[model samples]
Target chain A: MNRRDFKIISEWIKKESTVLDLGCGDSTLLNYLVASKDINGYGLEKDIEKVQESIKKDISVIQADFNVGLEQYFENNFFDYAIMTQALQENKNPDRIILEMLRVAKEGIVTFPNMGFWKNRFQLGFLGRMPISKSLPNNWFDTPNIHLCTFEDFERLCRDLKIKIIEKKVLNNSYSTNFFLKLFPNLFGEIALYRFEKTN
Target chain B: MENKFDKKSVGIVVPKTAEIKHSLSLDCGKVLEKFSLVFETYGKLNKEKSNAILICHALSGDHHAAGYHSNDDKKPGWWDSCIGPGKPFDTNKFFIVSLNNLGGCMGSTGPNTTNIETGIEYGPDFPIVTVNDWVNSQKLLADFLEIEKWACVVGGSLGGMQALQWAISYPDKIKNSIIVAAAAKLSAQNIAFNEVARQAIITDPEFHDGHYNKFGVIPKRGLSIARMLGHITYLSDDSMRQKFGRDLREGKLHFGYDVDFQVESYLRYQAQAFVDRFDANTYLLMTKALDYFDPAKDHGGELFKAFKNTESKFLVISFTSDWRFSPAKSHEIVKALLKARKNVSYAEIEANQGHDAFLMPIPHYFNVLRNFMENL
Candidate 1:
């Protein structure tokens, strides 16, 4: 839904490389990538209607839950990249699922709302309630974001897992941050996108 | 062109020229004197003698593969679709000959046919027959018709099993083999269905140890139950759901044991109508023959070895929805044929008609058969 994040992902994909988009709701990103880059892209969407929509577009998709891990359905290193956008926090085992994506693909791209944004922290501290913003809107009970994380937490986890961060970008809605994001991304940005390659 | 025969039992004046001759043969050093032999031919033969095609029938089918008797008002043969003038088989161009299997209830002799020595019907006493035995008996018929080799051997279902056997038993005697909706080995589920059908037949009180004639009664109920059970397997779950979901018959639920569901009514109608034309002993014999069929057994365990020496080109067709003899089984046949280095073409057509799809008017089935015949 974020145009800036879409542009960043679109520019990162290599020409003619195989791609798989996990939790590919409606398969919009993969469809766009396939049409423009001549990429052979597949989508994994769990919703029946979304699967039907993908089929109508003639895009190959398997309806499955990504949280269970991707080992049973695909071989190791089956794709060039596994992309997950606004979908990481919804997973039950986000860390293990990320490791599986890394195992299946040469690289993994994950984008999620920045929980430690200054506005979210200030609202939580002063109001004594969960923050609701443009990126994270739902109340705590009805929200799909069970394992929410901030940019710093994700980077530390990536470091402990020894995954090399190839590229990183922070966005305030559709606009990417300039030098402010590199200095203090959690305070200035509302969403964070990271592309990491398996180091070992 | 029409010769009439007076059948005593049914008092049915059928065609005399279509007389199917029967004989008791002593094979394996007279230890097994089973009912076996050749049947009559209808049309004339071509000059080159290479225009012959052997037509094998399915379960509960007989040598009456085509044509109707002048006196009897029954319809033409079962496979009249592909076995007539200007049809895919084109009786005009090919000389077709069908055989009653070794364990069938037709004029050739089966469980219901009287055993000469015992002066009673063979019934359950009939020795277990293999598909190989059916092919071996057809050899006699081929000889009787003066056919050195067949241009092609075509069959479907159990008939397809016989066609495969013909290819393996006398490889040199065939040029092409068409096997439809058949398998090299029966699956566990298929065997289980047959077991249930057999149980239905044997459990009836009127069966009387396969000697119901002593009580002047036939196990029609048991036979009908068996047919009902067999009929269910002949259709796919999707087809059944589409044809008869939870739809009730004529009236609302009385909560009695009467036929309530439309499927039940349909199965009952099928079972009742089937009894009029078929015999109970025949059902048992034919099913037993199917159960004993293991084409790979003769080749020491490797199925490919069975077709190793065969030179016949094969065309194996399977229907997607035919779960009774699924496409996977057809693939097994094709895989073995491929490994044997035989020329084989396979098509698993998408159809919802289930195992009965082979007998139905599916365009893809006809088109594929037509194309294959033209190329041949």
Candidate 2:
């Protein structure tokens, strides 16, 4: 099933654009983009099974760690877009990876589950326990979302890194966005998608 | 794309020999003054002569890569499962050529061949050759066939190393390369196994300093043991255990060392069959060739620099369970190709068949090959 964030992420990507999907799990995003846009791309996956899955689908994927840096695999300004979905927070250095993405591609599209949602806040404030919701579905001790951030935190980080925020799409659990949800995305939006490029 | 040829019908073909009266300069500073190469071809070479594809064989593999040698033959070529009319290396679209290397025993100039200098079998006197030497020899065969450039060079295991060497040595001569279950260089452990296999043959009582040919004696026991050891490395533990667990050869075990387990019997049969068709000195040279394969050594110890001039698009594949030539080794090649900024595709297939998985008819593996070839 295509995630709501992926659908939004696809809209920002131009047709036939070359993509490098970092932390590409099973490469469903790459496959979908290829089928719909006829785009040429490769995926970098650390999981062996997922890499095999991508290969079986006839998708080109390299089994590699994103944390190890992309300079070894990609040349500067090589790809039209470098995309990472629901995998930024899990990276060792999300800021460094974003910078590397901009160095390798003209633009980068990133999507992650927002940590500042009202439900997550209520669980921590009212229940006096670590938040656990449908979006963040892991126990506190066993979770990959190590560097989770809200929409505001990501925007602030992007500004500090001199990365131009070209576009942003705030989405609820079901993808529908109301006026109030747009106004207070950090508190209401479950997932946040952004398209950014390096500032001149 | 749909040719009306029956997909199931075996391509009944015979191998031919190309007599090259010219000397081949070996990589180890030795020259093969004259030799003949036994090779098999499938399909027609197009008008442009551009559809030629070379299939390099592994250590024990021969010139028979596809089709049945005889009409009554029960099995087709060694790689028949993937080289038929509609198979991955589709004969309908590509002219496939596979040859027995210079030091090979299968109808080629090898230890079994009579040396013109002394009018005796070369045997152990066969000069040590490298993968580079093998590629150069194949290049001569290509020149004789009037093929300017090959559409693709495809191989697995040692054969894959040959494919890589073709791209590195003759960069512009190849358009694509499919290297499966191969490595840039053998690990120390890999060399140890080859050394042990060589020792087994050399230490045999029947082996009289490689003079067995003159004495009309074959190192059967030593060769058999070497084949058995090679067989164990070819298959994964899971595969061997699955194929032959603790099952007894007989209904009950005698508790002695006389082939109690079914696995022991299976290894014996494999060894016997291999020794009957293969020569001891040829095996020694092949292993030595494998041990010395390191394309990066001459390029300032940089594999990426070695491919700086290569123009061939690569499709590198490895099986997950192939610990002998593990995914890690395959990744080293891929990393170098990526660093070189060459067009490359890699796949690690899910398989438990180990190193021999490259020869199997796994759907995913065949699909990857077909996809890459179609795209090429």
Candidate 3:
């Protein structure tokens, strides 16, 4: 929950609306939202220790397994927004999870590491080894990011799911944007943040 | 009483009886005329009176929630683990109030007390009390203390049910509700367990139709058997095995009905101790209260509907191995709160101690509770 990413997500969310954060580890973002935006926020995390930390911050958190889905916990369109920050790539069923998010919330926000960055491509194509950059900072076998993808792949997923992209931010490992990264987001952007809604 | 006290304890204190000037119209359609409530308070009531917390007790629990009655007393209160200074309840930060519920025998107006109208003890005629009656009566105690609202109402098991009732009955008066190891309503199996315990007391030859006290003979056999049965339900099979396995008491069987295993001796000893202290008529009333608690009943059998008007935030906890009020029960509460769009935190703690785990100072459980209390 760096200041830059927090600024982007905070800008996207409306003040005083209900928010549900998926896989909200420690609830740092929701804690900020509660203080700044005064939004009614909740975190859904699996780990008990993280859940306890989140609760300590006065953030409402529900301890639940991510794979089992949210059908049992919430009704459709129960929240104004469902946000998953830098955790989309770690999910086992990325497509189903996004769709479930859209079903439970009126809008969805997501961020993930882009696999098609120049450094990652160079490591894979030129050096013939798995990429180990700051954005994706783990060995291929040890990484929790099972569904790591490019900006292009994510937009394609949005298109396939009939999810209209409201806004998209292409940032580097340090969460900043430049002219070059904006011009060639698919090739140079190391991470991506997207806000989307169903097309009806 | 002014001597130095343990930092971990609420220290030696005496229970006080509050006279309720107003008559209580119970849920059973009986009016309790001019009753009194025995309670113990830990921590100071701040100038704003905003730090008050009411501790609701489960069945078999009394006003002795924390601290000892005297300096030489061997044991502290029932919830001494989490109610002292710097503990979860945090006596230093919050004004803690624990009361013996109506129909309880611990110096509270109950079956063991004499009726004002009649010159006799109420005995079996105590008028079956419910969770609703208890909450309304507790409100009288709050009025007596001149407190405007409670910071939180906390309880485990039957006490948890009262916490739920408070959120539903007096939503605005409570800022938070911490319900641990409790259910909205008793499962059919749970009612059966209570029924068996009641029968154990009722079928005793010396019970004398709930007037054993007047007959100068207590229903020791019946009440002891009831305690033995309840003690089993409070413990997990694994915990029982770890505490007392197949090891014989004397390293060999007596071969008759003379305590073959360590568990038998332990159960007998525990049951006898309980029988000596607890009243059988009060036990019957408490079980009935546990049986009758159903906040959802008035809301068309929908628990979420019952929570629709709740203004307070919630923290519901459950233990993994607690078969009496398992994690599944807590899930029902959390799900209902979610359905009602209320702010709630749910923790399904991994514990090996069964229903009794809620009473112990399990590190993870205490960690979560302390964090929640700190924020409050």
> lDDT values of the candidates?
0.76, 0.88, 0.92
Which candidate, 2 or 3, has the higher DockQ? 3
Report the lDDT tens digits of candidate 2 across residue range B283-372: 999999999999999998899999999999888999989988998899889989877877677777889999999999997788778767
Question: Which residue pairs collide, candidate 2?
Answer: none
Clashing pairs in 3: none
TM-score for each prediction? Answer: 0.61, 0.83, 0.96
The sequence of per-residue lDDT tens digits that candidate 1 reaches over residues A1-200 is: 55777778888889888887898877788878886687777677666456545544555554456664265356578789999999889888888888988988899999999999988998899988898988999998999999899998999989988889999888886557768777888898888889999896
Q: Please write out the lDDT profile of model 3 over residues B242-285, one tens digit for every residue.
A: 99989798998776998989999999999989988899999999
DockQ of each: 0.02, 0.30, 0.80
TM-score for candidate 1, please give it: 0.61
Expressed as tens digits, the lDDT of each residue in A1-200 for candidate 2 is 56666677778788988888998878898988888778877888877667667765667787677776386567788789999988999988899999999998999999898889999989888998888988899999999989998898999999999999999988887776889788888999998789999989
After superposition on all C-alphas, the RMSD of every candidate to the true structure, in Å, is: 12.7, 4.9, 1.7
True interface contacts reproduced by each model, as a fraction?
0.00, 0.30, 0.78
- Location of the lowest summed lDDT over 10 successive residues in candidate 2 chain B: B1-10
lDDT of 1 at B36: 52
